[model samples]
Target: MSKEIRKFCHGAAVAAMVGLTALSASAEVSLNVATVDAAGTLRNLAGNRLHTLLREQDAGVQVRHIEGPVLGNAAQVRDQVAEGSVDIIGTDIAWAAPYSNFLKATSFSFVFRDQEHLAGVLDSAMMAELIDEIAAEQGVRILGAAVLPSRAFFTKVTPQRAADFEGLKIRSPQLDNWLESYKAIGANPTPVNWNEVFLALQTGLVDGAHGLPVDVQPNNWHKAAPNVTDLEDMFGVHVWMINETRWSGMSSADQATLVAAIDEVDAWMTATAEAESLSTIASLLDQGGGVFITHNAAKREAVAALAGADKVVAFPEDEREAMRNKALAAGKALEGQATWWAPGVLDELQSVR
Candidate 1:
């Protein structure tokens, strides 16, 4: 234990500590995020928020965004995420049906009455189970479900009654089940991509396009067709997912930070989507010069006949009936309130809480 030897050993220990600290600081992670929405669209909002949150949570981590068709459409992005070609993707549940049957539960016609019902299901244990199954089977992680408004029809020819849809050439996603539903309604369902929808309508390639008012208004779909129908048939659910391998490779601290950030963003997205729905409908009517058609009960029943009521419950038949009874006890939660900024919305949002 000479003084010189003691000094040298102490210096060596200090140097090792410094080196380890530097190594940890120098670690860098990069992730690629893909989405079908154009830049600045609500679909891209979640992606952008995620990128910001990641950077704020970890300066060493970097996220890159790919919008439009760069990574292909939403359906293509799902495959890319599963194959690890893309590190992350914002996708629709309808497109993920091929990979997971749990999605079929959400796909069931009229499963949800409005945005609140849809949000309730997404925040429920059922959606968590579905996400976990997808993660295990497809090798991708579901961050959260991004909300959107209920989908309705925007047609060139005004349909006062559901019978008017007969023989109409309507543009819809090429999913066979979806097309079959439209066919059941007596309309000729033409499958077309979102990018091709405008031209399809303008050129008379299709007579109508189906989507949410918020989705259709932003895209200026009403300019091509003047009539908007409030069928309230379907709503949009965008699932944010990341490649499991990449997520697993991250440090424990980074993984926690990423998940927490996504949870916060999901909460914000739900409220934003609810607010946007009303403004979107107004914009379509006033700015886009479209006529809004409110269907009567008989007409709605006709549309329902075409939409068909198919339920997918995870429980046995007896248990399913019991669950339905429980849901009925909840009973018409949003009844008699059709507009946003209504009195019961905050309570409805809280009920799901």
Candidate 2:
């Protein structure tokens, strides 16, 4: 062959290879993440970390975060994700019930002993299967559970006993069993959306609200209520989810990378959330603007008595037993798994006790 012809063929081969490589890289997937937390909060940490990890995994992959109520409340975000209007969302199980009745199982109060128990349950095969089943039905995918501590009641008035809650109106999301539980104790439970909670308290429309100290303190609920009662209620298990249609459209390699990124973000979120809740509570008390009250031992006993012998009678007999059994079984199955947080976060969670 002539020297000029040989050089021309070599250059064409190089150009073809470079073009294929560029095409493959450009095929990377992109997703949008939405959360209820505003700027500079631990709640945004999970989404932020996942976004970073996804980028690191694939240089071409992109994740855009929409924080605060930019996409409406958590419930609205979930609906948007389901309808494919949003690519991803972070929301709690309570919000999932609107999309799937099976999620009702995860809403059972006190079903988990602590964050570790809840983590174990989510990581279990049975729970994973259930989540997948629900996700398929709802047109979304459960990436994993975001770690948050148990919620407590913050009030302006100090309660000497459970009976002290009598006639006081408390703010809560509308959940029938939860309402019934509060009503059974003589307190009037009122449903209020998160956006309206601050006003509800400021106007004395509600005397108290239930939330994690870290969650409420960041918003300065202490300024409105001035008193917080560590009435350990339910642990909040928020799920990181993505629209199934968007997820299914991703390349297999990109999907694997995305899942791994979510796992790392979840671990970071769990550690940060638990630490922040405790630290915020201390900060609030130190500010001297609010008083932190421990539940009266006798009053706590009375509340437990009302809950019944199972220590989780807030639900019907069959339901309560089923939750306990599932949690215990999940704990046993995850006994030595490093991902399960051995000795359990249950011990660390007792600090709030």
lDDT of 1 at 154: 72
What lDDT tens digits, residue by residue, belong to model 1 across residues 11-94? Answer: 101111121222232467788888787665676777788788777766566788777677777777877888899997876667
Model 1, CA-based lDDT:
0.60
For residue 254, model 1's alpha carbon misses the true position, in angstroms, by: 2.0
Model 1: colliding residue pairs: none
* Candidate 1 local lDDT, residue 244: 73
At residue 111, candidate 2 shows an lDDT of: 40
lDDT of each: 0.60, 0.59
265 Cα displacement, candidate 1 (Å): 2.4
For 126-198, candidate 2 gives per-residue lDDT tens digits of 4444444545688876766665776766678866455567788988677654564455445788998776787
RMSD of 1: 16.0
Task: Please identify model 1 stretches exceeding 4 Å from their true place.
Answer: 1-26, 57-61, 295-353
Alpha-carbon TM-score of each model against the true structure: 0.72, 0.72
Cand. 1 TM to true fold:
0.72
